[model samples]
Target: MAEVRDGYKITELGEIPLEWDVVQQGDISVFYNGRAYKQTEFKNSGTPIIRIQNLTGIKEPVYSDLILEEQKYANPGDLLYAWSATFGPYIWNGPRSIFHYHIWRIEINEKILDKLFYYYRLDFVSRELQGKKNGFSFVHITKSLMESHKIALPPLKEQQKIAEILSSVDTQIEQTEQLIEKTKELKKGLMQQLLTKGIGHTEFKQSELGEIPVTWGVASFEELGVFFKGKGIAKKDLSELGEPCILYGQLYTTYKEVIKEIVYRTDIKVKNPVIGYANDLLIPSSGETAIDIATSAALMVDCVLIGGDINLFRPNQSIDSRFVSFQLNSTRKEDLAKLAQGSSVYHLYAPSLSGFKILIAPLEEQQKIASILSTVDAEIASYEQEKAKYEELKKGLMQQLLTGKIRVKVDA
Candidate 1:
């Protein structure tokens, strides 16, 4: 960790390191707020327009459905940052295009620092800017504020070296993530084949749940276990402490039903809050669109599942919860589509879910299948956890290296 020195003059931030120089963002780069292009002016034929909606901090840029005239655009190398609710600075690699006013384009002058180096610098300082925002309504970054923001800079060679080191780490993380994704795709293909056609068996029979072995039987979801909807807990009742709760937003796209975020209720007033025990199956009853939510259904293990939007199915001893969860997730496409009621949003009722049928194999077979799938799931989870740790490390390094607090030597 770098030590803070007292000699530097007072500015927006208290003090700085003596060796580092303080300069406003504008002094380093040309800053411009994105221009607003009229909706009618947008056409499908021209260049894609970057929007706040398309700006994910780490992911590749997604082109918006709307496009604008080529003249109103940011160049390929310019850095883009969102001014809206979710804020982070990222390098623009997509085609040159216009963007909504909610974004800002930062074009760095080559004499000051490497553009790639500053891209990471802006990313590091963005956290401070976000913390200063007043409220959630319209958290934005003003061009004036950005221009006045101070940063430490090093020699040009050092800037390139630091950016290269951090960029290498990023590349490794990205490759690991890609590998993890490929593993998941492989598992999905394996599950589709294994669950449908048993190992070493070529024949399958037509059943209500779809094609299956002749030995398998069609069973109702109710027959597998007890089903109940989650109890309602008002937002006002939530707390930072006390009993932990899961929200619909915490669900992940992967098969692992890991809860990434939680809300707590100190009052503990709600009764039968649909608390789940290990080996319970949880399914989302409603979502923005039918089948839009990934892992909308998942198996619970060693975690208390709490959410009004989720439905809990406690399977009896005859059924393995993991196997049931896998079957539900795999077969839910058609069922969820049928239960979808609204035009804009799709929802499923508990009654409708309870009426859905499932295929029941012998208890021993269920356990065997569950065990096989669980092994694959465990591997996938390990990869995900590794990726998360790498991402956190990358973020921390970006905060330090990008600001020139830690300097690197460049060969040039």
Candidate 2:
């Protein structure tokens, strides 16, 4: 390989300082495959089995009555690599859980390698490892293939320094995440209360939905706004620059609460472009789960073309669309789900949307409620931006520190 600098040489991974060594990852850390625990083995209480579902804290991982060999037990802060449908390196923070077959237990040879450093290194290249998985419907990472992967090894002190730097960023991210969760809880309460009880109201009245403020009126979604189903845009019709478009899938991924910017634009011919109007709320009409895709975002301008599986709700001037969207998030999701069709992917059709009832206030009152909630949304966005900036900084540091472009001091 050609020398990149006087003290640096290009290697298989990348350019590195001459002092550092490139070695097989297996040489530094030994990997053990987890036992494939089955449904029949599940018990009400025992050691919690870490499943792919539990990775996102979606569901509490179940327990197993059957005890496995010594190597299978995983503890808090142990490094684990999950490879199947979802792939990544995770510092196991849960209890002493029996891991599923999809996850691997990684043991560092402390004499040569630091656990945190290798975890961060594995995290840095997790996407690359994920790409190595073989399967069409599902991906699997074999122990043999992962053991042969290469790593750029640094001195123990430098490795610890890099890990410390990355760990500090992770600490900031964790704190920010907690703050985000708290802020969300606060916002949710505001949505539920403000949308129903309203601002500073002493009087209350009962209705089919629930008891709401006396001054507030109840209305079907049809009365407050008009609903439209979007057309399906074929893959052949997509391009970089064309008429600005909003896709159904994007409703779940992008565009939260209030959207001032649109991400996608389409070039291909559209039969009937269901252009977005001012104050039009867009949300997924169908998704894997009703609760997940139930969220909505309101547009502030006229945009052309809306993709299928998305339902558009254009509120009349009498109501604030963003306010109503927040209210839906707080209340109407379960109601909407009740009307959803299909089993696998629940769909919210026109009839269901029209029949849905909501507690409403006057236009000015609606605007005031929306403004108060928007302030909370802005605060959450600020925290998210800060967390993202810290993550970006860590990513830049990893690239430099791992490659040895920037040197870290090692104490004797």
Candidate 3:
């Protein structure tokens, strides 16, 4: 029922170039199921057992003293697919390990298909098949289902070219991620020093918050701010076009240490609706956990509607709002977390927040610290955007190159 484009033909895997062949994934490769291990077989040290968690890097590797058939083991560089609760294709970069039963060791026939190309093909297929199978216990894709999956294959050389292009994009994404991590580490080190020690200070004095700069002052949070509770707006009341708003939940899910721009809006009407002021520190009054209850962000804009379950702190003229937000999120997080109380769902009240103590720097010093941290945050955001752009580029290339919608140059 679909029209075939010129120079393309209709096939079981859909329309592909005239020179390409429609092949069952199993036809060009062999799938070897790994051995399932018994509890007693696990040991303190020997051969590592690769579980689904090991492949995903969620848990540490468990070792086994028992030896099994050679087919049960996967060595470095072997392409593998985890088809259990977590589904994806992985090229093993770890030591030689016996893979669990849930994983399939794919051995490609390289004469007709390049191994790297098949790896990319399997990755594409796995992503498509993920979460679509309805009746399974937990995305339990069987080996037969994977083997029987249909795919369009181009010439071996063309496959290699497609794989090379995708791999280059992947490398860029990896490097960008590394830069993001390094910048975060730098922020952590700077916060630890700046909050406690004043810049270029030689004298130090003991305070309730440990040793601080001699000239710095200490005060309870209530001394510097007025607490107000946001009223009325609920999740269902939010809409696409209306007055800009900040919800309590967004404090944890959306905004960070500082709120730059509002993403949510609502048209709902309420009596005595609360509006946030610039430099107001926002904290979620209720959350699923104590750590979540402690999360806070400073509103940088004026006149936005503030929803329920959020506590707003309006600082005095002398204090910097970003400085207070960074201090609470970094240096004072554990202390603030302890104030949160509840058995199931935690709640942090304005009264508890008011009594919390903080070290105060001169207005000029506070602004300087905030400026340095904000610049680092901007750098991280730029790298994140670059990473996302490359990922999108790879996704588009896969859709085009894999199906021969766009062909790569090959030697005669």
RMSD of each: 4.8, 2.8, 2.1
Residues 1-412, model 3: lDDT tens digits: 8687898998777778998999898899999998888899888899999999888876688899887889999999999988888877899999999989999998988899998898888878876775365534465888888888889999888998899999999999999999999999998998999988968889999999999998898988799979999999999999999999999989988888988899999998878988998899998999999987877898899999999999989999989889989998999998999999997999999999899998899999999988888998899889999999999999898888988889888878
Please give the lDDT score for candidate 2: 0.81
Candidate 2 per-residue lDDT, tens place, 159-250, comes to 99989988999999999999999999999898878887889999889988788888887899888778898896854667799988888777
What residue runs in model 2 are displaced by over 4 Å at the alpha carbon? 10-14, 131-138, 232-236, 268-272, 283-285, 292-295, 308-310
Question: What C-alpha lDDT, on a 0 to 100 scale, does residue 192 get in candidate 2?
Answer: 77
Off by over 4 Å in 1: 1-19, 57-71, 133-137, 229-278, 284-310, 340-347, 402-412
Residue 173, model 3: Cα distance from true site in angstroms = 0.6
TM-score of each: 0.78, 0.89, 0.94
Tell me the whole-model lDDT of each prediction, alpha carbons only.
0.68, 0.81, 0.89
How do the candidates rank by lDDT, highest first? 3, 2, 1
Candidate 3 Cα lDDT to native: 0.89
